[model samples]
Target: MTASAALTVIQASTLTLDDTQPRVEAVLVGGGRVLARGSREEVAALAPRARVLDHRDLILTPGLAEAHIHLVAYGFSLSQLNLHGARSVTEVQAKVAQRALQTPPGTWIRGGGFLLSELGLGGYPSAALLDEVSPHHPVLLYSRDLHLSWANSLALRLAGITEATADPQGGKIVHPLGTLLEGASELVTRVMPVPGEAEYLAAAQAGADDLAARGYVSAHTMAFEAPEAPRALQTLAARGELPLRIWACLPHERLAHARELGLALNPGGLFQWGGVKFFADGALGSRTAWLHAPGFADGSGTGMPLDPPDLIRERGAEALRLGLTPVTHAIGDRANHEVLNAYDALRPLAAERGVRLRIEHAQHLDPKDLPRFQGLTVSVQPIHLQADGAMIRELLPHLAKTSYAFRSLKAAGAILAFGSDAPVAPPEYRATFAAALTRRDDEGQPLAPGEALTEEEILWAHTRGPALAAGWADEGIIRPGARAAFTLWDRIGGHAQALVL
Candidate 1:
């Protein structure tokens, strides 16, 4: 297309997200890069022979980048049992029982997207609830957070988990043998059938297509899914079928292997390995996000911490030396505090290497640590506030004032990158924009109105901030020499479509 196409001009009300020239009337594109951007007459004179596509009524901005997602898994989830809005166990049972009849008797049933708190459970759910419906089929269901799993009796038995089975490190097996938290879910996942190369490729395509359809021109694929997931994505890029550019991570557990393979940060491509992903703790919905004292007002205790802080400190330095950003996931206050401490130690090295330290989810935080984010990339999902707001009130009321603090983070000098963390939530930018602008949850209740961001700030976070985090300078803006990838919106925060040159 680049070789055959003539230089083209797009005339739109464009939000460039460029401080020096924030708005432009026209942009000239050729060979997949911006040639010039300015008033229509000025740019048109420069490319008088260029084809023109007018969009005076729409708003065009830098193409969106989904800053965090499990690409392949979210793709497969589009075909799995979705318990997203199941209000009760009965509702969930009906879905599972129906699937059971369709599936083989001994087959494993897999799906997720129900919050334990939302399920009206006093504690962990029991296998009996599922056994009543699918006594023949082994069933494994995950809570919305993916940090907890509810397994039926047969599923538990298949994994050889019983009352005698001890909890695994970084995870827990709830009493009565039905619920597994954190790393314990691996017991069942490891036993489940693995997808072959063909399945992986298909899942990868499904995810990339869905995001592209949602108006994303790029995405940061967080590495928590199977290793085959990234491989499938890379395969898509190599085949030139990938719809969007990708900035991906490798699980910290694979750090040693990556070092041995000589894998390091390699930027500028349709896909690139950019960071080493580490989980410092679990999620709030699962009651496993490591918190400070008196955690979870409901007496769930301080949430479970995942990786050791020391590991992050030590290996993080190693990661920086190898040119890979050390990306740590820290949802709770304690988790963020600890990761920040580890990051502090890595700051000098990070500065030396010109790589930014990144923290994902920075959801709940201690006010004192706010300033520490000055030079770091804080990847957050405002969409999560739709549900987590209510949970925070019930579970961590003390944080209600500071939670989802987009405005505060910005003031503290952090580069705020927004994303959906799809499957956990949809990559619906409308929902994300609404949550950020209104500071409201699903119930239409305000979370922290003071933390709300303006439409321009929201656009920057969704576009330019992600590009900065991924170390891509030619993206997330409309300017000379920038990539000709953009999103056309009917309104500031509404229906959108991708337009990649």
Candidate 2:
């Protein structure tokens, strides 16, 4: 029971992947590392007294890693009003009304999961519809993509948003109805009371537990929530209660504060600081994706860019010097190109610091920019391909073949770290796998079938690619000296449950 001693032997149909194939009777564990991994006899001779934890016929692979997730925010969202699958405006209204009845008047009723397209609306829905459902309570519902939001009149009024209110920078207010897009959603959010320490801690726990339940053993939590979100996670890690290993990013705005606090890259058991996240553009669903020469195919004038490369370059170096990876949100071609340029300038420095610069969406790429992802981690959500396909065809037809170009990206030598981008897309790997492998959209239209990835490729992206993206070399692979984190199942890439450690 000393640091130099080994204690347990885990036997299974090991997916050591140490040599790219599954092993039948591997013995591993007890040193919190792979103490020994080989035929059962080989490992037993090395440490016969090691307590045995047998997985008789189960398949064992490296623990799955969700490269990108908004942990605390996702957790809080789970308990909030869920409107994710409402097919129509009426369905949304009915759900909001039902939730309102369950809560006292004047309490803020917040939920998300509505798709503007699914609502059968050509544009953003108005606040008037929601007003009719919860006139006494304030309500704000985010689009399934998290790019747009629909709020009731009361909520709009509380946020001081009116017909005369001008759209904020990088965001738009849909006319006549009071729905907000991109940056505009902040208007309503700013007025909401921040959760106390307890609330944050609880939400963090809920979110982490939910992901673990879905078979994720580690995650890279993007900074999209209050600072307390990560603080709550830190609290859990300190207590050794965090079930999944976490790599968290700080918002770019917080870089100076982190620097001032002397915060640097860290590994505190189940959690660590991995990067700083910035937004170069908004999302596709909200119509904020920054595009190329001839913007959206529908003529929306290429989407707007949120941050300039000049600024990203200036701040990115500082981030690297402090051991923080620079991760930017780039959904459109233009957005991806600009981030790539900035990263190109910082790549050498990033390498020197052992950091890997990353692009969060790399969803829609320009053919020319596709090659830029080589050696860089492109953290993408294949699940969004279903909903984005129709919009891609309608709004950005020219890039259709290359959009969500997993094959092309991989061929270009890019490290594709697949994720659900949860809260934006649900945290379901099966959906991610199906979407990437099938390339099927909501209308059953197959988009870029040639770009589809195989099931094995998809699994590798979700596991190894993400671990590499998060800079956790000790994870995502079943090998000597690697953490004992893993997911076991009756079958691989199918219905399964997390193997409790």
Pick the lDDT winner: 1
Cα miss at 18, model 2 (Å)? Answer: 2.3
Candidate 2 lDDT over residue span 297-401, tens digit each: 767688878978988988899999998889999989999988999999999999899888888988888888887788888898998998888888888888898
Candidate no. 1 TM-score: 0.98
Q: What is the C-alpha RMSD of each candidate to the true structure, in Å?
A: 1.6, 2.1
Per-residue lDDT of 1-501 in model 1, one digit per residue for the tens? 232239999999989988899899998899899888999998878878788999988998999889999889899999899999788999999999999989988988988999876778878999999999999988999888788999999999989998999888778999987899999999988988889999999999999999999899999999988889999999999999999999999998898999999999888779999999999999999899999999999997999888899999998988999999999999999999999999999999999999999999999989998999998999999999998878998999998887998999999999999998888888999988999999988778899799999988999999999999998999999888999999999997899999999
Scored by lDDT, model 2 comes in at 0.84
TM-scores of the models, in the order given:
0.98, 0.96
**How many clashes does each candidate structure show, in the order listed?**
0, 2
Q: In model 1, state the lDDT of residue 54.
A: 93
